[model samples]
Target: MNLAKNRNEIDPKFKWDIEKIYADTETWNKEFQEIKTLAPKLKEYEGKLNNAETLYEFLQLEEKVSRKLYLLLIYAFLKSDEDTTQNQYQALKSKIQAFAAEFGSYVSFMNPELLSLPEGTMEKFLEEKEELKLYKFMIEDLLRNKPHVLSQKEEALLASAEDIFGAPQNIYNIFSNADLKFPQITNEEGEKVDFTESSYFKYIISKNRDVRKEAFEALFGTYESFKNTIATSLTASTKKFAFMAKTKKFNSSIEYALSPLNIPVSVYDNLIETINNNLNLLHRYVDVKKKLLGVDELHMYDLYVPVIDVPDMHIEFQEGVDMVKEGIKPLGEEYLNIFQEGIDNRWIDVYENKGKRNGAYSWGSYDTMPYVLLNYNFKYNDVSTLAHEMGHSLHSYYSRKEQPFVYSNYTLFCAEVASTVNECLLINDRISKETDKKKKLYYINEQLEQIRGTVFRQTMFAEFERETHKLIDAGTPLTSEELNDIYYNLNKKYYGDKMVIDDLIKVEWARIPHFYRDFYVYQYSTGYSAAMSFTSAILRDGEEAVERYKGFLKSGGSDYSINILKKAGVDMTTTKPVQDTMDRFKELLDMLEAEL
Candidate 1:
């Protein structure tokens, strides 16, 4: 697959119309300056938050400025992601970062001040001003953290330290995506290809064992060369989280991270425990792979390659769009119209370019169309990715339309549920309609892999994160050697004795960018489980389930994540969701084994 070396060479229709965010750079600059000017004015309302009218006024002004600031910031961030090397957009993005820190510092007093108000003042304010009802949840959520709220000066210091706190992640992004280079490897066709971050997935899943093995070795080998550097980078990030947690008086970094979402550490522990108890199922799946691949032993590189040889299912971009449209018909015509409009308009950046960001994501502000970025390779998984990201976009669209701006942005805990549910709908629809035995088998295999990747694999990642943070909290230094050993042992525990755990796979943790975000990967597991619950409901109850699912999307941050999911019929606070997900995986594995 040859990639375009220049962005201009790609068709305009294939690229996202990010220009629609602003008419031009001048217009963006105009708004940028306006935000800078408007931000500091919030200081005038600093001490006056004690008064009902002044508090209402300050909240209104804060929302207005925040909406505009996000629009400008999202545009610059997406533009910079398109080509990280572009100095112009890079500078634009840096300017927004600095402005954001300054703005955050200026507004930092609001929460602490609001928390300091007389015990019943906020409730009285809410009663006196009907207009303030729009912000009732926002105010209450802030006050709920009264114990964690620092003094105004301390809050300002933490706000000002935002950029300094995020330096490690910034550095990792630069080194991983911009500076690092992979060695050239020979492909199946005997052509030498430069292994890049975007190309890593393509090579790793190759049908040819030699090609993928070489690619895997070359990629992790490059990471191994910088093992110490990457280890130190990750350590700094972990320490940053620990420092913040201690300063905020939380019991643990993981606790601090999940508190905002109102999730308990037990939920995290439940996932790890469930996955540990079910390792034998994963081992069984691996054993199936070893037997089907007819290998004496299964290595890490061989796990991704398909066991059943079905004809290649190459889907073009428009075909993928059409297929996705049909797959989601269960969501009703109104939902279909929104999906079609996003695809018809330039809501998605469809194809990869020279320096565009790798991977796919859906992002936007409350005031704008939800935008999706894709490095589309026209494969079956690309279509699945389209379905997944469109789930996120549609969730944003509904939330923005139904809820106030303050509650429009849902937490990551619920965000993944929306996306994974889409993937479930797509996969189930495809499997039901596929007539050819081989293709049906292929779809079954895909479902199996989905459970493996999203459920089992992510749980492994979540456990790694939990253990590493605990180790750091316990005063163990995370040097390269120690990190590698801990990771290798985790691999052994997860994989059991079913497969050969290669030394190269031990360094895999060095390449994961998600680790920097701290306790984030677990959401993928929980979301997938919740999605399975939704899929079962839709299948069982028909339109009733559809309405309930849509209600969950529109609920947004209007309530807590678990409550939102409960309304959708899944209670995540217990061990039931994880068990249900494991049961679903077992059912799928049974079908695949019977077919084999």
Candidate 2:
């Protein structure tokens, strides 16, 4: 019955400790000044990088400044996310962003200069300097984009343009997060409540039909009104990516986006093709939902609220943590110990307050403890989110502890795999233990929805991204009408014949912020598929699998994403992972059908 509370109203224990990164604002500002001062020093090593010993020292200094910059930026961003309306943190975040661009501009000469060195120069340098060997993988990653490095002046120009190119996402964030307003909707109790971005999901999942319909219309209706402006913003972002990619000599933006992570176009293509091949599974899930809800036709708004409601299902935050702990036990005690340390250390911002960010993420630098942001609503799904984010945190913890700072961060290609694997384990554990029939059905619904959203829906998103980029690549203008047609047709194809494809659903493409990110959503599909393999291995093979999985976590950017996943027992080059994931999906559907 309560709405969002003020930040002060939330318990300090539930809030993450930003002070852990910096003791106070003074300390943050001090580090901010230090990074600014360090920014100009990169020029000192501009021409000196060709010398093996000099390059080694320069790399060390670069790492030192990089670590400090990341910590400062993370603190400012996390603080701002806690209360986005706070102008103090907002200014600090902007200051950091500007500083980051300057820093990037200063360091831009390094790669181009290194590439300018004779081709075998790197190999000779690595052979000569022992310290340079530490950066072998790093140097290789840099040289891998040798074709795209451009001249020193050109690279600096591009680097300095970073802030200019970020205008669209920044504009979108401002509109969606701070400015956009939803109309108030009457709830199940006939009480008027203001709908918000954060509350939109909660309302959609409400047991009441009226609440879901009203909230859906109120949310997307606002988007519909602003569709023209939103369309322009998204189109600008798409063009920016296309321009950058073509400037760098890549064929398309998707290749530019995926190449750095060593992901091939075929992997992206295979994910789409495999998902399309299994569209029947998604359609089957939709049919099951329609039957369960007893609706003659399911509307787009009717998709979220579960068909089975468990009245006593309100799970406390602490209970969710405990559930995650037990669910991840198959990963062995050492893994759990590190996870427990993170849980005990206030590494999570556990509840939502006014102006807080809507979704969940695990974020931190190599220099800091892994931190998670969650807006816990005390539902069973929150527990799954907890488990998912903990997976990310643990991945960071292991990577940071094992690899050097340069190799600490993993790519989006492999990032979601760990999180989804944890979700699989958590849902599997809950489903196996539940005794009540309705509650079991509810859990099954939750699991199926996870697959529905992650595997099917995200692949659908992936295809949209691919198609839109291709359209731009082929010199076709992306008008709002064309974007809508593409999105609605795909929506219809994925959802199949059981549901009513509302006209308003066509406007949904204008609202997805990820479209601005350029080919980012496909990883959720691929990562989920890879995670299915790891989850099956962990459950069936036990300790050996856990150790291999641990190795994969620690590998980080030490190797390419595919190789890392391969070492972790998932061979993504073949369609086997996707097919195996579909098998798991059907197996769950069988269980849900038997339970019903």
Candidate 3:
């Protein structure tokens, strides 16, 4: 049997080029020291930003410091993620994080001071200094948050507490990724294999019911032992958001979280309301799964198993890249060229190794190539994840290439759109070309599951998050039992009476890392809805739609997420996108039902 390899055992070609950011730790340390001194220079411009030249000088100096600081932080984080157990890189990460807090405190006065400027003063400064015109949008955004800008001293106090605010997430990460352990389980061949967080999904989708049930029980049961500890960590994290929201004078934590990107609370409400209205469709899909699997009871462990049998197909990393290239050809030559460049330059770290971080993400700084991290297990889902993460990388690639440092990063509200669009395109390409009936049914099933997971499942998590935060706001304690009850009930509601709603599934909420980010999962649902809209348009209008979609990719945070998506042709404020996604889910369900 194949076992997980050590990081050194993996081929160098499969790993991302970390040295591209910094040659060595010595070089990183030297720059770290240099950046520490530059923050003082920023503090020097505190009271003197009223004048045009001084403000311009301050902005330039701040940008220089910020850019360098972000580069340092990125290097530290990448190194730490490469091996979570390595104390040297972990210490390096901690040092950078602490300094980042210090840096935030040092510059915290800038916003309050800038907001204090006389009306039209910033516009006059833009006219006075040609270089300051580049920062006009950023300045306008800052002024837009004037009501929330605290006094200089109060801002400094909050900024200095950044590390404290981040402790819950840090603790949870170390505990889950580096410390947690699972017992060995027997596979279908009666061979004992290690049941790990990275391999749990592999077993949970096994053809053998016993293997799936054992894997499910072992994974969540391990989490159950430490459920209370995780509950405390999650509660502290939620309360932090509540405190910060009330301190900033927002109506609630959700409003506070969404306000930064100019997203209205109505968007969040619309997602839950629309999904609730369409819960019958999900129930219908669940009923179909139960009937197709020919099971007496469909439990949580049975949800992910493929309904139809297909030959086992293992997708090699290069094979997956070639498939993605073909799948995304509709985006035209330029987009494919950039995508190919990333593959050639080793912008991805493929294959799982012991001690590496679990799951996947796309990360980099303004100065570095957008890099992807994955635990590639030779599954088709890994291939799809390749398309998903590269979607993020290319989005970052385009945004950083086109926008300045200030607006280079897009908001989380629109972050999932580009990635989901890639998945939709890839699955559509496969379904369009596959000639075999079983294979066609498989692709259709895959797309349906993607919608169920990204749209329906994530919306459930969104509702769970909203409900928990509301409890915290009402001064109610969120205990282990409370979190479990909330999560278990939502599963019952979303899955309907068709699913068994297993007892062990209650601990599932503790396993979600996104809970630390506060109200982030909802965007996955909304973004997937918007991506379906774009995918349909591209399929229909050809180059006209592709060009508009590319324009949306190039647009970073220069405008609000809603405005940017609107320019790209979808208006997310209404129920249209959600309705479109529901319609697609039903259409696929009909196709699968007929084929079966």
Name the candidate that leads on TM-score: 2
Candidates by TM-score, descending order: 2, 1, 3
Note the residue pairs that clash in candidate 1: none
Q: Could you give me the TM-score of model 3 versus the true structure?
A: 0.85
lDDT of 3 by residue, 1-596 (tens): 04778889988888899899899899999999999877888888878999889998888888899889988998899888988988989998999999998988778778788888888898899899998988988988888898897877888799789999999999999999999999999999999998899899999899999999999999999999999999999999999999999999998999999998889899999989999999999999999999998999999999999897754778888899998888888988999999999888989988878888989999998899999999888877888999999999999999999999888898888899999889889988988898889889889998999899999999999999999999998889999999999999999999999789999999999999999999988988999999999898888898999999988899888899999999999888888899889999999999888888
Q: lDDT by residue for model 1 over 33-64, one digit each (tens)?
A: 88888889998887788877898888889999
Clashes of each: 0, 0, 0
- lDDT of residue 479 for candidate 1: 94
Q: How accurate is candidate 3 locally (lDDT)?
A: 0.91
The local distance difference test score of each candidate is: 0.88, 0.88, 0.91
Clashing pairs in 2: none
Candidate 3 local Cα displacement, residue 328, angstroms: 0.7
